[model samples]
Target: MPATEFQQSSSSSSSSSSPSFGFSILSRRRDQVHSHSMESPPAGLENELEAFQRQVADRFHDLSAADSGELLSIPWLRKLLDAFLCCHEEFRAILFNNQPYLNKPPLERQISDFFERSVKALDVCNAIRDGIEQMRQWQKPLEIVLCALDNQRSIGEGQIRRAKKALIDLTIGMLDEKESSTALAHRNRSFGRNNLHKEHKSLGHFRSLSWSVSRNWSAARQLQAISNNLVAPRSNEILSTNGLNLAVFTMSYVLLFVMWALVAAIPCQDRGLQTHFAISKQFLWAGPILSLHERILEESKKRARRNACGLLKEIYEIEQCARHLNELVDNTQLPLPEEKERELRITVEEAGNVCKSLKDGLDPLERQVREVFRRIVRNRTQGLDSTGGGD
Candidate 1:
C-alpha cells in the first residue's frame, strides 16, 4: 500500500475516535478490541498490543511536554531513556505472550529486522556513553574553576591565575572535541568490558564486533544503518500478522528516534541530524517525536550552538560561563578592582552551578545508558532464542 493510503486510513480512524491530544485513540482501540467476537484472534492479545501503543504514546507525550528549558537537560534525557526502557519492556512482554507468531513467516521477518536494527542501536548506546564520559572530562575543569573561586572570603591573583589556566584547558578541550572528526572509539570503552566473557558465551552469532565500535565508526552512518529499509507494513502484511507487524514497526521507529535524539543532544562522533524520520503522523507517538526532532534541530541551528560539541544545555552553560570568566581574568590586573572581583565571582558562581548540575546528573545518566545497553542485549538474545535463532 502507498504511504498516503496508510495515512488516510490512520487519519480516518483517528478522526472517528476524536482523539483529543494523547489518548482518545487508545480508548477507541481498547473498545474495538473488546468489541471483537470470539472468532477473531484473542481479544486479550489484541488489547495488550493496543495498550503497548497507548503506553508508548503516553510516555512520549509526557516527554514532548517538556518546556524549552527542560527539553535537552540531563533530567529530560534521563526521562527519555526511562521512557524507552519502559516501552521496550512492555514490547518484550507482548512478544513473549505471542511467541508462536514470532516464529511464523511475516512476523518472523519483521521481528528479525527489528532485532537487527536494535543491534545497530547497541553501538549508538556505546557512543552515547562515550559522549557522557567526555562530558565527565569537561566536569573536571569545571570543578577546578569552582574550587578556584567558590566560597572564598576574597578572590586573589593566585586563584585567578589557577582558574584562568583551568578555563584555558576547558576551552581547548571543548574546541578540540568539537572540531575533531575522529570517533571516541579510541577511548576503547564498551559496556561489555565487565561481562565480555559472559556475553561472548551467550550471545553467540548475535554478538556484534562493533560492540566497542571501530575508530572509524561514524554515528551518522550507524544511524543510517538502523533506519535503512525501515518502512510501514502494508495492509495485507498487517492483516496477516494480526497487527503485530505494526508493533514491530512502532518499536523500530522508537529505537531509531531515541538513538538519533541521543546523538543530537550528546557529544558523539560525526553527529548529524539528517536521518529521515519519514513517519506518518498517523501514529499517536509520531506527533510528539517529530515535534521534538524539529525543536532539537532548531536548537542546533542557533548561532551559539552551531559548532558546539554537544547540544546539551549544561555543556553550553559551561562553555559560555568559562568563556566569559576567561575574558574577565585576562583583562584584570594583579590587585583586582572591586567591580572586577564581583564580576569574576558572579561568573564563577554560574559556572559552579553548571558543575553541580553535572555532578548530580552525569552518573545517573551514565547508569541509564548502561541499562539501555544491557536491555538491548538481553532483548536481542532472548528474542533470537524465541525465534529459533534469528538470521
Candidate 2:
C-alpha cells in the first residue's frame, strides 16, 4: 500500500490490458511431439523448456542492464519472478515467509529460491566467477559474466539503504503470500538511497572539522583527522574510501605485510582464515579461484547441465581477463630501486630473469587451461544434447 507500489500496481494493471503487453517479440514456434514419446513435460503437456532458456537469458541480460535490483519491477522480470513465486504457491509459500524468519536476507533468499526452483541451477555462475578470478589472480579474464557492478560502486562509500517497511509490505503480495523479493528490493532501493543522503551530512561535518582553513599550516593540522583511522587500524576494511589503489590496500593489510616495514602487535583472526581461503580459492589468480568454475561443474552436475550457456559466458570472461593480465605483465619491464644505487645492477638482472620465467610459465599454463575449457565445453554441450530439446 505504499504510494509508489500503489501507483505501480495500478499502472501495471492498466498496462497489462493493453495490446502491446499481450504481444510477443518472437513468433511462437510449434514443436511436433512424437506420440510414442508422450510422457509429457514435467508439469504438463507443455513444450520443452529449452526455448524458454533464451527468453530467460534475454530478460536476465535486460535485468542486468536495468540493474534496478527489483525482480518484479520490470515487465519481463516479473514473468520470471512469478514463474518461481507462483509456481507452487501453496507448498512454496513458506519458502519466502519463513526465510525472513530464518534470518536470511530476504533478497538473497529469493535469489536462492530462483536457483533452487527454476531449472535447478548448476554451480556454474559461481564457478565462472571463481575461475575468472583465479585466472585474474595469475593475470585477469576472456573475461565474462561481468554485468558491470561498477555502476553500483559509483553510489559511493556511505551508501544508504531504505525500504525496510516497503520491502516487508511487498513481501505480503496479491495472493495470501503474494509479494516477492523482487518487489521488496524495488520498494526498498529508494529508502536505501535516502540513507545515503543522511551519511553525507556526517561526512560533511567531519570534512569541515578536518579541512578547515587554518594558519597553523602544520603536519599535525594536515593529518589530525586522518591520524586516528591510521593509528588504531581496522584491517578488515581495506577497500574503504574512494580511489584506494591495489598497492596501498595490500601494504596496509596482512597479506602484503612482508612488503611493508610495520611490526604488528596483533595477529589476524584465525576465523578470517576461511574467508581468505575462499577469496584465494574462488577469487585469487592461478590457484583455487581460477579452478572454481571447473570444480563446480565437476562437483555439482545438476546445475552444470541446466546452466551450460551462461556457464560458457562466464568462462569466456575469466579467460579474457587472464590473457590481458598476462600480456600486460609480459610486456612491462621492471624498474630498479633508485635508493639502492650500488645493488642496482644485480637486482635488475635478478628481476628480469624471474619475470621471464613467470611469463614463460604462464603462456603454456594459459594454453593448458584453454584445452581444459574446450573439454568442458564439449562435455556440457553433449549433456545438453542428451537432455534433448528444440530440433
Candidate 3:
C-alpha cells in the first residue's frame, strides 16, 4: 500500500458515497432559442389573431340598425313615388290630349286644355285603357328619359310638371278602375281580339325591360345601402349560451326590420284613413295619364327633345317603379318584411290599391286587364278588326 494508491482508494470511496443527477452532455446555453417545437404553426399566430380581433372590433362599430341609428327606414318613400306618378301624368296631358296617342305632336293649347279639364276629369275605365296605352308607349319614354338623365341637366321643371300631370292623370284612371266596379267590369269585357293583338308584344316587351331595370335599381339600392349604411348587416356577436355560440347580433336585424316594416306598412300618421281612401279613389287616374305621357315621350323623342326629354325619363322611371313592385311580388323570402309590405302597398296604391275592396284575389281581374291591353295594341297597330263579328 503506497501513498498514491491509498489516495486513489479514498477518491473511489467518496464517489460511491454520493447520489448523482444524470450526466449533462451540454452546457447551459445563454443564447438558446426556446421553441414550442411540438406545436404546429407556432405561437406567433397569436399576434395575427390579435390583429384580426381588432379589425372585427372596427367593423362592428360601423354597422347600421344598431342602438346608434344611422338611417331611418324609408317610411315616406311613397312621397317620392307619388311625386313621380304625378309628374308622369302631367307630362302625358301636356303631350297628347289634343289628338289620339298615335297622332303627331299636338299644339301647346291642345296640350294645355288636356291638362286643365278632360285630363283632370277622366274616369277610371278610360284611365285603365290609357294606362295600357301608356305602357305601350313606355318604351320610347324610357329611352328618352335615360338619354336625358345621362346629360348635364337631367331634370327640368317644365318637363317635371308635364310628367307630374301624366302621373296625376294615370293615377286618377287607375283609382277609377280599382274603385269603380262598373269600370273594371267594362275593362274586362273590352279587350277583344283586336285590342289583344296590339297589346301582347308591346306590353310584354316594356314590362320585361322595366322588370330588368327594376332589378338593376334594386341591386343598386342594396349596394348604396351597403355604402350609405342605410340598412346595414350587423356583425355576428357570438357569446356562449347553453354550450353554443348563440348569435346575439341577429336580433338587431330582426328588430330593426320589424320596426321598418311596421312604419312602412302602417299608414303615415299625418295621412289618415280618409287621405288613403281619397288617394286610392284616384287610382284609375294613372291609366290615362300614363298613356298620354308614353305617347308624348315617344313623339318627343323624335320631336320635342328638350321638354319631352323629361317625359322620356319618366317613362323609364315608371318602368323602374313597376319593376320594383313586380320584384316585390316575385320575392319569396320568408316573413315578408315591413319594408316590402309597405312598398307593395305603395305600388298597388299607385295603380290605386283596390285590393282592399276585393273578396279573394286580384288575379281574375288582372287577367281581364291584360286581355284588354292586348286588344288595345292590336287596334292601334294592326287594325282593330272585331274578329269580323263579336265575342
RMSD of every candidate to native, in Å, equals 9.8, 28.7, 33.6
Q: lDDT by residue for model 2 over 151-268, one digit each (tens)?
A: 2323211211121221122122110113333443353343344443443233232122222223232222222221122211122111121101111121112111110100010011
Name the TM-score of candidate 1. Answer: 0.83
Q: Whole-model lDDT, candidate 3?
A: 0.26
Q: What is the C-alpha lDDT of each candidate?
A: 0.76, 0.24, 0.26
Per-residue alpha-carbon lDDT of model 1 for 102-172, expressed as tens digits? 88878898899999999899889999887777777778877988888889887788887788667655654
Q: Using lDDT, rank the candidates from best to worst.
A: 1, 3, 2
What TM-score would candidate 2 get against the native? Answer: 0.19
Of the pair 1 and 2, which is ahead by TM-score?
1
Model 2's alpha-carbon lDDT is 0.24
Off by over 4 Å in 1: 1-40, 176-211
Q: Name the better of 1 and 2 by lDDT.
A: 1
- Candidate 1 — worst ten consecutive residues by lDDT sum? 183-192
